[model samples]
Every structure is written in C-alpha cells, then in structure tokens.
Target: MSENKTSIRKKHMEFTPMVPETTFQYADLSIKHIDAENTLAMVRRAIRMGYDAVAINIDLGDISDYYTELDMLWTPGSQNNVDGEPPKKKKKKQQRKDELADGIAGILKKKLIPPPHYVDVSQLNTSELEKRGKVFRQFSRITFTANEQVVINKVFIHPTILSYDIVAVRPGEPSVLDTLSRKTELFDIITIDHLEEERRKWLSVSKVMDRIRNDGVFYEIAYAESLMPATRKNTLFNGRVLIRSLKSKNIIFSSGAETMLDLRSPVDVMNMSLLWGVANNEARKMISGFPKNLLLQAECRGTGNGDVCSMKLSDAEKLAGNGEEEEQDGASEEKVVVGKEEEAEKVKAPPIEVRMNHSQYQALLQATKNANDMMKKIKASKAASSS
Candidate 1:
C-alpha cells in the first residue's frame, strides 16, 4: 500500500509529522450504511490527510427519516422480537452460558467489535484524541427545498438541532434564499449546494450578497461532490460562480465526504480553489482561517453569548506566567506603600504660584489704564458740572 501524503511529508520534513492546525475536515458520519467502525476509519483517514480537526455533520432533514425507519423496525410482531415478549427462560439461560463461552472464544481470537451505531460522540471519552491535538466538532445542516416557513420555527426550537456546534442552512428555492438573505440568527452558513446556473442566478443580486456578508455568514463548497464523476461538472461550475459572487470574503471549503476516499488534503483543497477562481491567499483561508472563524462564531452561538475567550495552551501558559509576575509586583508595591506610610510623619504640598507672561502683563496693564482713564473722565465731568 502507498504511504499517505502526510507520511511522505513527514519523511521529507524529518519530524514527528504534525498536520497544520488550520487543516480541518467536515464529513458526514451519519450516513445509512456507515457504521461506527467505518466512521472511525474515515476519521483516521482524515487524520492521515493532515486534518487537525473533523466536523461530523448530521443532516436534520435526514435524521427524521432515519428515526422513522427505526420506528418501523419496532412494529408489533416485527422480526426483531416475538411479540415484544422476553425470550423463554430455558433458552435465555442456555444463551447466556453460550454467550459466556463465545466471549472467551472471542477474547482468544483477539476480535474487537465496535460499539453500537446509537452511541454518539458524547458517550465516548476523547482523551486519546485530545492527546493527538485532534478535535471533533458536531454540526447539524438542513437543506430547505422550498419556503419552510412553517417548519422553520420548529427546526430552530428543536433541542437536538440547537445542541449542535454549528447550524448551516442550504436554501433550494428563491423564496427560501431570499428569506435566508435577511438577518437571522438561526444559521451560521449559507451553503451553496445548488447547481451552476442556480448559484449564478441567485448570487447575481448584490442585495442578497450584501445581506449575507452583513450577517457574517459563510458560503460553503463541499469538495466531495466535486470528486464524484456524476456531480463533478456541476460542482466545479457552481464553485467558480460562488467564488465570483462572494469574492472569497466569507467562504469555507469542507470535505463533505461520506467516506474516506472522498477526503482531500488541505493543500489539495487550496489548489482546487485556484480552479474555482479563488486566489491563493483566500484559498488557503478557505480551508483554514475562514472555517475557523465560522466555527468560532458557531461556538459563540452554542454558548448563547459571543463574549468568551478560547485560549491555546501556549497562550494560557504565557498568561499564567504574566499573572504570577503581576502578583509579585503588586505585593512589592504594597509593601513599599506601607513602609512609606509608616516612615513619613506628615506630608504637605507646596503652594502653587501663579505668574503672567510679558504679553499677559502688558494686556492687564492696558486694561487697568483704560479703567483709570474712564474713572478720571467721570471725575472731571462731575467737577466741571459743579463749577
């Protein structure tokens, strides 16, 4: 098997093989056929692709369908159980003994089975992932095919939807697009999931672009779609038009891969951006800075307030050192102040003297002379009147 591009880089770079912190992978982990083991494998492949972070996306629209299927499986007299009754006691005891024997056999075989699909990220301890400095963020995205004016309210208030780290909206119709173009706190991303023509037509209006920009919402281009032969042409064309419309201001590039094969490296993504009309600098940011800012904004929303500090370990360490220094300096200053208070009996301030410059003195003299001259004129008038 060929070594991963990341491992190749490590060989050349001669180091512990660190992926750039800006590299992120946004992929679908909730697909119908993707089990937990498959999802973990996809994440591992992403890590090999040099992604420092991965966002597991759950589509809000698809979740209901999934649960609905699950419900159908539990129907009365379903194949899953015999009328929902407990297994026979004799069979249960025999099955338990057989399972114990199978468990011993499994241990001897060194076979490890993954947890059930129902186990979400919250249920797992991520200390090992943290040790690798790898982060997994959960995002919920909903694509609106029409004006879901009625359902929009329910979607926003849904507890599971609100718990997601990020909420992205993809409007499929003009009415929905226009509604999304306005300021609303319900979404962080205005993803461009339409065809080439539709993307161009919708983004042609400057007002819509301006509103999206004003709202600080990001535009997303899912690269995995571009990798698929069927959707490649549409993806490329739509991406080019989207970059032209947004001018790479608030754009993010996500893998959107349902499987590991669809994943690409961050550098490859930037190179792909060049084909989409995004400049090299902006392209780099699409995979890095832009997505990072979007995640930060999403975090602020999830926390219900934007006023918070998310410091890196290095930054926290530096601040801790500075705080200690400040404490020492403050203690010394306090001691000095106390000593000064004890040593000094009484302190008095010298009186402040007021002085006029030559120009000011001359002006004052002129004013005094004018007053005396006026007074003398009044006295002379009075004497003349008396005479």
Candidate 2:
C-alpha cells in the first residue's frame, strides 16, 4: 500500500512545461502559483509570450482558504506545547515557540510531510529557454493587503513570509503606505489595485515618491487592469499618476495575470507605458530594466544581515559574486600557487633547530625565568589598577 502511494505521487509530480525558444530581459513579478493545471499552463504561456523571469505570488488574504483545503494538521493550538508533556530538550521547546510566532506550526510538526510553503517548479524544463539565452527562472513571492497595521507587523518577520523571494503589499490607506515604506528589508513591491478605487485614493504625489526614493522599493502597475473596460479608467489614472510622480523611474509594468489569457507580451506592456506619460526610452525599461533592479535588490535582501543568508541558491550566488569565484573542477593547484606567489615564497620554511653549549643554555634559561617574572609583575600591577 505504501509503495502504491509513492508511485502514484511520483506520477502526479511528473510534468513537462511548454518550452518554446525564448530570450531574457523582461520580468513579471506577479504570477499566481496555485495548485491547478492552469497555473502550469499560465507559466507556459508566459514563456511563449517572452517573459524570462516570473514570481509565484501567494496572497496572505487567501492563505486560510488554501491551507484548510490542503489539510496538513492545521487546528487551533496545534503549535502550542501540551500542558503536562515536558519538552525533552530546550531546542524542541524553542522550535514550538518559533512555530507559533511564525504561524507555521502545522508545517513544522509534520517534518518530512510538511505543508507546501511555495509552489514547486523543479519539474520545469528550461533547456530550450537557456539555450536561447533567456535562462528561464521562477521565484516565490508573498502578497499582503495592508488593512491592519498590527496584523501586517506581526507577520512581517515570519520565517515563512521572509522566505519568499519577494514580499509585496497593496496598502489600503496613506497611514499603511507610510508604515510599508519604513519596512524596506521586509517588503519589495507595492502593487496598485484599480478594482478597489477607495484603496488607491491615498496614493499621493509626495507620499508615493517618498516611499520610492527612501525605501528604493518598486511600484507595480498591472497592465491586465488596463485591458478591462470597467477598470481601464482607474488603471490609467493610477498608473499615469504613479508614472508622472516617479518620473518613469521606479515603476514596474506586470500582467498580475491569473490565467494565460491575461498574460501579454513585453512589447505590448512597454507600448502601454508610453501612453501613460513616460518617454519611449524609459518606456522600454518599465518592463525590463526597472524590474531587474527590483529583483536584484529583493534577492540581496535575503543576503544581508537582517534576512540574508548563504543558504539560498540565489543568496549563495550573490555571496559568491562579492568575492572570488570558485576554481574549475580538476584545475591544477600548482599553477595557482605559482601565479600568486614569488619563487622564494613557494618553498615552506624549514623547522628551527638550535644548538647551544651548557653555559649558553643556562643563560637562556635564566633569561626565560626573568621574562616570566616580568610578565607576572605586569599582570599584578594591571589588576591592582583595575581594582
């Protein structure tokens, strides 16, 4: 029965994404990474449409819905320690506390059978994309709709939340935008939602520009919203205001696409930017250059002291870039030593060997005794002064 289950899961995991030849440059930071066949199809469509990099977005608002359905030991107080059961080790006790703090107790408890934190794109074949110079890549991102400052604050440093490649938010008010700006290391992109016009009213000239300047965070305007008949006006208004305020500098044009139908080519998105009050030169960067900067900055966030660590693949690559790159496999070490050192320095120093007569040996011993006495006297004097 166990063997059958394993085989069944492997079969389900097996998938081949559509691999049309493509090149890199453009990025779409918001790709819905849900557990559906259509999500894979959406990624396939993205590649075919010329997107080189994409991020799988997980919305905090819909977490409960996704978690409950996945069903991996999620219950009230599941992360809490049992009253009478003693924690065998301090490490185990601390682990439980972390689980509660991060609200990932269900995932922590299961060990090997942990709940999914991000979409698995390991099965994706990118050989064709790589061959074409695109090097297709996928990243995980978490979206938070900032309604309650307290709620967003509590989860801001959550291990699972910070683990994503990007952390984006859609602020509902001016105060929330102010709060989001200060958290440079936690949040990456500030998404604009035209569907909720009231939520976007707080977006001001000074406020938007200040957040962009101070935090160096990017503002994402979804082109998909512009295509909708009802949302087109608000989308154009919000995007143009953002473009005009930032002077076409910090804006990123994305599809915010849920399905393949919503995804558009990079050229189409860039063309739309020109109509939104940006120059043709800056228009091209709205899709490619600005987003590439955002991705690099977001990636480096995990490589710095607050959240950066060498454990992540992308983080490891950044860490490697800072210093010397690794030598090729089977390279000669002798060549490296010769290249880096003088001929005299190449040979190791010989071990010291000394010979002394009886009288000389006695004098050396007496000198050593005098030096030990001098050190002891100095230490005693320093101790006396400290007292």
Candidate 3:
C-alpha cells in the first residue's frame, strides 16, 4: 500500500515548496524601444510568476544632452518650441482651474517629459489584481552610462536620477569603473551591458569585483537578452566572464525581459542560473536573497532608511489599537507617579550595560588611559601654581 501511494505521488506533479514571500525577481522594464503597454504587461507577468517585487530599470544617457529646462519639465507637447515662442502664461485663477480639471498626468505632461516608454503603474488596476492572492511592488532604477566625466557629473545632479528608487551606472571604460566602484553614495548597482564586448573585459578584473563588494554595490546581470538569437553569443560571453569573476558575491540576476514571452518565473530563473555556472545554493540566492538585499539597500538609499512602503488596513488598525493601549497605560502610570510621593521616589533610572567587541574594548581602554594622562598633567600644573 505504501509503494502504491508513492507511485501515485510520483505519477502526479512533483511537490515543490512555495517560494518564500520575501523572494523577488527584478524584471527589466527598460528594454530599448519597449512601449508602455508592453512594460505594464511585463510587470503583471512578473507578479503572476510569484515575484514579490520588480525594479523598472530606466537608462539615462549623456546627461548633458538632457539638461535643458524643457527636459526638466518634460512637457509632452513642448519638446521644442516653434521659432522659439515661449510657452503661454495663464492667468492665476484660470491656471488653477485647468490644472485641477486636467489632473496629474495632464500637469506632468505640461511640465516634464516622462522617460521614454515609461509606464505609470499608478494608473494600473492594482486593487483588482491584489484580490487574486498575488501582491507585488514596483520600484524605479535609473541606469547611468558613464561615457564622460562631465556626463557623470550632470547625471549626479539630474533631478530625474535622484527621484529614482535605485541609481545604477554602466561604466564606459575601465577608468570609469574604478571611479564608480569606490563611490558607494553615488551608485547602487554597477550595470553591465551583456551585448558590449568591452564590458566583459572590464568586468573580469579582480580589483573591480573587490571594490564593488567592499562598497556594497551589486553587479547586475540581465538574462533575458540571452534568449535572443542575434545577441546570444555576446550575452553568453559576458555572462560567463561576470559569473567567473564575481562568483556569488553581490550578484543580482534579472530577466532584462522586454515582453511577456521573454519573462520567466523565479524558479525557472534559478534553474537558468545553474547553466551560467552558479552553484545550486547560490543560484537560489541570485533570484531571492540577493535581490532582497539590493532592494533593501536601494530603499535605504532612496528614503534614508529601509521602510516597508505599504501596509494592509488590518495591520494599520491593529497598530493604531496597540498605540491607544500604550497611551492609556502611559497616562495611568503618569497619574500614579504624580499622585503618590513614594512611587515617584521609587522610580529610578535603569542600569545600562555596555558590551564591546575586542577592537571597541581596546579603543575604550586607550581613551581611558589618555584621559588619566591628561588629568595628571592638569594636577601637576595646579600644584606648581599653588607652590
């Protein structure tokens, strides 16, 4: 009977444990020439494929080229003014009415040019999708290609780049890579274009990987491009060099998928990592653990602290209730302290324990010794003055 049951189980689909809730897949929404609909479709597909989060990558090239005030405003119909005619100024009362009627998109289109093929996730019917048991989050990542020092400088100051959740840079040469690797505050990911032959050579350097690891930056590998027959050779070559040099240290594998057909589930992506010479445990980390870490770092970089951006109403309500209870307890305690002299007298400061590691303890001892020497000098000076 046991044998029969085992056979039945084998005949059916194999049992695979559910992917952890924290596991995420970074799908490439930045595929060149991709439209808004296609990008939104990719986001939906990622959510359906069991990914908890996706980073919509945006590439900003030659920052100087995009530095005009018009670029800043990115007004859809105002890319260039005919015969240098200035934009029309509206009456204050009328302008407010138009803005209120047109809504955010209308105002945004009037002020700034949105990124090429940028999909506004806010407009998507996410509430309906969340009902299906799949909850997903979207983040923005700006990929800067370091072609020139001037360009890099322009990108650093660019308001659009700062607005992104994650900021990444693709160094044009080895010198640029070296410069960016040490500057952790300026970059989140050192992006590599798999199709570029030059990038493979640059990525192969041991020092480059070392600096990246020390500075807490991730090495990005976009796997979706490998599926294309035209770019397959170059993609594989870059992938081999990247995996060989970095191994498992601070690597994030994302499907630079442009469309729905190119997208793969997180489990499938883990299996794909095996083909790239990644170990089983490491492969799992690429899709799950590594992405989570990258997002956490990006979150901290963006908001000054890693905070969960969204919460359920139930959770919020519970937190509110707990806060009320805490407030009540605090009030009662305060009343007791004020009303009872003995209770007020009994309230004392809690003892603080200072525990230190070897290095910290040594530093503390050195500080004490320095203070003692300074005190001795002061006492000697006092004695001399009295004499």
Candidate 4:
C-alpha cells in the first residue's frame, strides 16, 4: 500500500510557483520590448531555467514619478495659491513644528515613492526614508532591515548585521572586521544580487550552501538578465555550480523578478525545475517548500501553506469517500437549522443566576479602570514623542 501511495504521489505531484498579484498581468514574453522590458525577459528566462519563484523590487527609484505626482497633488493648501500656483506672498519664517508636521503628512499620504522589497532604508540617514519605512510597514507583510555601508576617512568597514541570511558584506568581498563589529540584528533570508559581485565573491555559492546547512540562513540569489533561453547557459552553469558543491537538501532556487514581464506562471516554474536536473520530489519541494519556509520565518501569510517539511498526496477516490461521510453529517445537521430571528432570541435569553459579590465586582471594575488609564498614558506618551 505504501509503495502504491508513493507511485500515486509521483504520478500526481505537480510543481506550482506562486507569483504575486501585481506582476501577474505582465507575464507575457511579447511585452518584453516595452520600457524596462529587459527585467521582465530576464525573469521569464530565469523561470524557464528552473527558478521557482521571483522577488519583485518596489524601490524608490522605480516609483519616483509616482511620488512626484502624488506630492504635487497633495501639496498643502497653505503652501499653494487658490489657483493652484505656488504661494506668491512674501516669505514668512515657518515654525519648526508646523514645518515638520507638514513634511510628515505629505510623506504619509504616499506623496513620495515607495521603496523596493529588498532594499532596506535603515542605513540611510534621511528622515524621509525613516518615515517611509514606518508608513510602508503598515501595508507590508515582510519585515526588512537595511544594508548600511560605513565609511571612515578612506577605509570601509563591514556592515554590522551579519548572519547567513542577512550578511553585512556585499556579494563580492569579505566584510571588514570593523564594520562587522557594529552588527545589530539578523534577517532570516538575505538577498544577494549580481550587482555586488565583490561581496558575493567573499562567499562562494558553495559557502552559502554550507551556511544554509549549518546555520539556517535562507539565501536568495538574483541574476541580472531575463532568466530564460538567452541566459540559460550561464544560469545552468551557476545552478550546477551551486547544486554540485552544496548538499542537495540545502539549496533553494528563485527568480529575482522585479517587473510585470518578469513573472512566470506556477506551471512554468514546475516544468523548468524538472529540466534543471532537480529530482521530481525535490523540485516540488523547491518551488513549494523554500518559499513557504521563508514566508513563515518572515511572519507572512497567503504565500504557501507554511509547511516546509513534507507533503502527502492522497488518491481522489479516498477523498471522495471522506467527502461523502462529511456530506451525510452536514445534511443531518442542516435539517435542524435555526432562522436569524430564532438565533437572536436564543442569544437574548438570560444567563443562569450566578452572581459575584459587590466587593468582587468593585475590585474588578477598579482593576479594569486602572488598566485603561495605564494604556491611555502609554498612548499619550508615544503620541507626544512622535510629535
């Protein structure tokens, strides 16, 4: 029976790559000629090359125009003429508090561009970037830390935060000891792109694999070009290099897709994995297991089922039998349904006569009031500090 189940699972198992909604509409290859077309092509090709998932970049650079437009649209009424022109009155000295409030309000309303998913703003000294991070946090499901560069005189220091997942060094060079000393926190997954070949060189793909095995850093490597046929040869080389050097159990492949055209349908990613010499069972795990594990670590939802360890596929006939049993139980329960009015009346019924003493009730009320007062004070303090 076990052997038959394994055979059945092998026959039915299909790999599916999950693409984000924003990039779903632009998955076609023909749209590659549009502005920033190469990014899409690279992603598609990467998918064809067996990358199971893609990361979309939402950097400040890409959304600069949108930010500019929003800023113009959301400009303060006091700062503009009634006719939508700049204030023509003689300049008056503005209070620091008012100016700060206006600036913060403009940014909070999406007046500025949004940053990309992987780019962390913590390193930047700009107050605007800090504000942007806070605002974006509300809508963002993934938590990201910035990669800061520290420079003293002419020498460079390694980034402070270094872990298998979130390393301080770029892709090419070893991080300097001085910089590593300032280390703070670690991320579960650190993204490495081709642009920083220097830091990437410090740790080879094999080294990254070892870290993934020994430490639990989930590394995401991004290739610059469209990950399809044109880049297939090089991608395969890199893929083989990483796969052959590392123990197979530790590696996860993904497409670093940033734009609309960069997305690959889940079906395509599954097929591509098969072509990349990933075993059938392992390929399914790569497309499903890796992303799911990463999402859970990041405290995100709706990515995968959040099960990275294993999957069990059952026969449809067995499922049908189970469904029939459930249907019969449901049918019997449904025969005694209550209307909304009846439900409301049942809920309105008085509780059994169990009463607390006056002293106990008074104590409970006092405790609740105290808790509320404490909460209010804390909130007020936070508001005052932010202001």
Strongest candidate by TM-score: 2
Positional deviation of 91 in candidate 3, in angstroms? 49
Which residue pairs in candidate 2 collide?
302-308, 303-308, 304-308
TM-score of 2: 0.59
Superposed on all Cα atoms, the candidates' RMSDs to the truth, in angstroms, are 20.9, 17.4, 18.0, 23.2
Tens-digit lDDT track for model 4 on 1-387? 667534422211112224442112111111112233454454445334433233333322111122232223323345532454344342332343467678667556653322222223243233332333311110121212223333221111111111011121222233432233233123344433342323334345454346444545454433324265666665555555455555445455544554445556555655666554667677655555665554344332112342222212222222223223322322211121246555421111111231444344344434545655687799999999999
Instruction: For each candidate in the order shown, give its overall lDDT on alpha carbons.
Output: 0.55, 0.63, 0.59, 0.37
Candidate 1 residue lDDT tens string, 134-252 = 66543333332323544354455444445444566666556656776653566677666544445346656656766877777787888888887888888888777777776778888
Model 2 alpha-carbon drift over 4 Å, by segment: 1-23, 62-128, 205-208, 305-387
Name the TM-score of candidate 1: 0.53
Which regions in candidate 1 have their CA more than 4 angstroms from the true location? Answer: 1-33, 60-147, 194-200, 302-387
Models sorted by lDDT, best on top: 2, 3, 1, 4
How high is the lDDT of residue 301 in model 3?
59
TM-score of each: 0.53, 0.59, 0.58, 0.35
The digit string of per-residue lDDT tens for model 3 on 211-302 reads 77776778877787778888877877777778788767888887767668878887788888866788888887777666677666665553
**Maximum-lDDT candidate:** 2
